[model samples]
Target: MKTDADAAPLPMLYRLYTAGAQIASPILDRMARKKLQRAGVSKARLHERAGVASQERPLGKLLWIHAVSVGETLSILDVIKELRQQAPRMTVLLTTTTTTSAELASKRLPEGCIHQFAPLDTPAATKRFLDHWQPDLVTFVESEIWPHQIASVHDAEIPLALINARLSEKSLMSWGKRADLARALFGRFSLVLCQTDPVRDGLRAFVQEPWKVVTSGDLKKSSDPLPVNDLQKARLAQAIAERPFWLASSTHAGEEEAMSAAHKHFVAQHADGLMILLPRHPERGPEIADMLRTEGWRVAMRSKDEAIAPDTQIYLADTLGETGLFYSLSTLVFIGGSFVPVGGHNPYEPAHMGCAILHGPLYANFAQAYADMAEQEASMEVADAAALGQALCALWGDDEVALLQANAKFYIEASRNIRKDVAGHLLALIAP
Candidate 1:
């Protein structure tokens, strides 16, 4: 619940933000349309960015969820499923801002859910969206703060919540400078189910009541294992029969070079071992493949359908939506973005598939999750390419890999109820 404080006038900074958004709406709408077109969104769908619905909102109690992009969208899938099971009469509208996420939603969202491109953060666009959907409850996943959107929801007297709410230190410092605006924007949320205690504590500073920010567990932990294409997995398994291999997934710029050096060490030990390089951005496939070739590694680019020949040292899996297939095939996995300054990709993804997880020192974004996994001996952190190679070489044995996989799976099994609890909280927020 919203209190008198939440109902107060918007702060000066928030007013300025809303005013600026209103003034820039037209230009922003045009830019969003152009981006959608470039992303291959049809002319009919382009209007979605302007809060024009592509399909009629389903009748009955509708719960609307807004996720910023792919990661956030994936994180909430289980929650939506849980909500559907518990509230069979309710229809869920899942809105995301990226075309890739929309495509994923088309394939993955549960039966009761509807997917849409989120409106541009402008007064008119948000107003149109809310007026059309008239969601009974609204949720914003993970730091998607738009002043116009929040104010419009509050003005509509809707109960809004922030689930899996995470706040980075950088974001805190930035918002901390404008306490009034922060309060105005954040206080409107009826509840905040935080992923971490630090984020909950930090957000309490901006909310009307400290009790509103509860430290609920990360919903991603409860997400189902990444989807796999059985046909593709089987084909790859046949092609890679009886060969030692490990994956270096979601890698970044400098991390690829490090992994290449590690692969050199790997091949020196097991001549037939394959190193699968899955970059965070797949468009860099050609560049990474070229770099590997220059370094004397025979690279097979997945996008080009290059076969993993007997002599192929690095199989660059640069295509999208195949992470699950690779993880299913490899027991030893190095989750990248940690070797570089990037705060690391999700270790849970690999862990859920029972892949023994490895990473570098820099994973502050997932510090708590990593710490928990480390305590259970579910994950290992390597300092550099040499250490990564050594760790992989050591973990190649069946017993070593099995232990890590068991511990990681145990961690996942223990957290199975987090999303259920979150779903309960969200359901409670629905209007009576």
Candidate 2:
């Protein structure tokens, strides 16, 4: 089914040489080892085989789903849940790249599903992993396209699909330069379900196979908000009782500065206000705390046994997998990574927790969902740092917090059932 255009020579030798250089670098080797150690605990559950591994071999056709990180792993939880309910006997093998994502997936995936840390993309490792698992169907979440892995699956005659498929503008440009290579890589997928029309068009430039490509709304929209534990919720509620608090969730590098500035401005008016800044990567906790401390702010880190004192203006929630706790405690929440060039993180978590949502301008990744929320007045989009501070201050001063909460609730209700549409299509593809 591949076109003549796809048969062009690839930069395979160059790519192999580049990969060898990276592998030979001592720094990269150490980092890879550390990453493997962190993610390998669950990965060991699988039996190693031809460039792949079997996590759990339930007696039936195995359906393998691979998602790289926290966002992608969380986005597909609902689909896995639905699949379990519909086919109790079906074995699902889930793989993730990061330790945090693996932990999250293990906690959420149903009993029939097995979790593993996906092997590093080296040909030997990929081949060993595939040989062990021997999946009948393979579904990749988001844009994690491993060349050798996909090619291996294709060679084995396994049905392959790319779910919630997305290609960023930056990625598109890079792939555009190697159109033939891209075409060969993508042509391996039996189906390619894109998140948006832009993604579809972007993919079409490299992949001319029209029958395989189609658009399905983002799978993240269909994801259920992570559940909150009663004990944790109660403890957080007590900690935040009657205090004016807002959450800066999933903050990236530059975003913390913007958030700290906004927090300072908000606290100037309401002296007792608190800001909970949750960095996207918890490893940056100590650095963020030091940054805020240098600015004469009393910052308390979650990892430390520092109590939330009355004088504490900022609480650095540098813990992993606890966004729900912060969102539940907040009256208003700002989803970070939007202020800087990094695409926005999910806004649905705050909406599900009944928190008034605020974001910055560059949310091209989830533009449609954000657009809908903004149009319905369920969320607010600020122009820049100053506007973000102003919006937060205004929301804090408003007496009817119920209005904001209601807007968030309405948005969540309206967006329900999107997962079912995506799941239905996937089921049809995998039908026996």
Candidate 3:
């Protein structure tokens, strides 16, 4: 009856449980495909044979980075770039959970890094993946701690670290249920680089050695500004054309309706105002457009290459990996997903883009960053949809609000070097 955390291998019953879980995932996958369409990601099988072939090529020391999604991948991109520059001969293995993450990582990864799908938590798959990659040092971005994967790395006698790690209250509560198991799994890591004091405190509660966790600030703060080519900037500028525009970027399900309402409110005041809605998930684009259209707003979906005409009320930024475009074009930006209990999307991107910022009240995920911005008057928090509309209207009507925009610009400018600070800390941990 040994639990997964016990050093002893997962037991037969646990194996059956894991197998059942894997089988159940396909049913969820089918449902996701029906409900989410293009946003649904199928589980990827590890290319064990190909991985083994690459391992046999006599590559030098391998450093493996596992990032779950686009955010995590982008968060650690600077660190990866820095690590490569410092150790030119070191081979890097990048693993991601989703196909979108993998695709984005593939496009952005430097010359020496190889991208692969991380294996499922099943023992056999984990073992196969570990056997092929033979990573010398393993670092996970954020909190994607897989029990079997950590155990497999420990079994392989490889060093492990968790960088930019943060645990939500809900997640911490779930782990508290199996504290002993959590401790055992987390104890295998040589270091846990936490993002903030709260994250460090949470990890300390579950780990055997409290000092193993270090606070290094969130890596999201340090990410290089999203690249905007000159052509794209000009095109976006031409499309926007001095229209008072506010971007609701990385919006979640409940937030879109709120944004649509806010857009209508702004339109009432400034007839030339634009509301650019970037849903967090691309699949939600069509659905959101339909909803907005139903509300009598003229909608232009980005995927359809529709231009934002003078009368277009809402521009649906429905594509992937182009949030930068929307953020840059925006005079003011609202970080979405906070209106409901979805935690919130990253505000740093828009802040860094020098746009006046607004977000909903629920931003526990980026609490520290948001607190700093709020204190500095670099960002504003709205209580509900009504406040959201009010904030947008005020910013659109007044030219003096540009002072608040300047504060946001200054905040981002001053903090851009956080990546260098974090990269230095991470390298010392891994290579030292």
lDDT top scorer: 1
lDDT of 1: 0.89
Tell how far residue 206 is off in model 2, in angstroms.
Answer: 3.9
Q: What is the per-residue lDDT of model 3 for residues 1-432, given as tens digits with 9 covering 90 to 100?
A: 111233333445445656774666445434433432354433233243112222342367888888988889999888888888877788788887666786798689998888776655655556666776777788888889877677667766777888898888788888788676777678777788888887888878876678878788888877778877668778878988878888888888788888877877887888888888888898888899999998888899989999888888888989887888777777778888789888887877887778888889998889888998889988888998888888888877587468778888887777666667665655565543
| Tens-place lDDT digits, model 1, residues 397-417 | 758789999999999988899
> Which is the winner by lDDT between candidate 1 and candidate 3?
1
Query: How far does residue 385 in candidate 1 sit from its true spot (Å)?
Result: 1.0
Against the true structure, what is each candidate's TM-score? 0.96, 0.85, 0.86
Poorest lDDT segment (10 consecutive residues) of candidate 1: 1-10
| Top candidate by TM-score | 1
- Can you list the residue pairs that collide in candidate 1? none
Candidate 1 lDDT score at position 422: 94
For each candidate, the alpha-carbon lDDT, in order, equals: 0.89, 0.77, 0.76
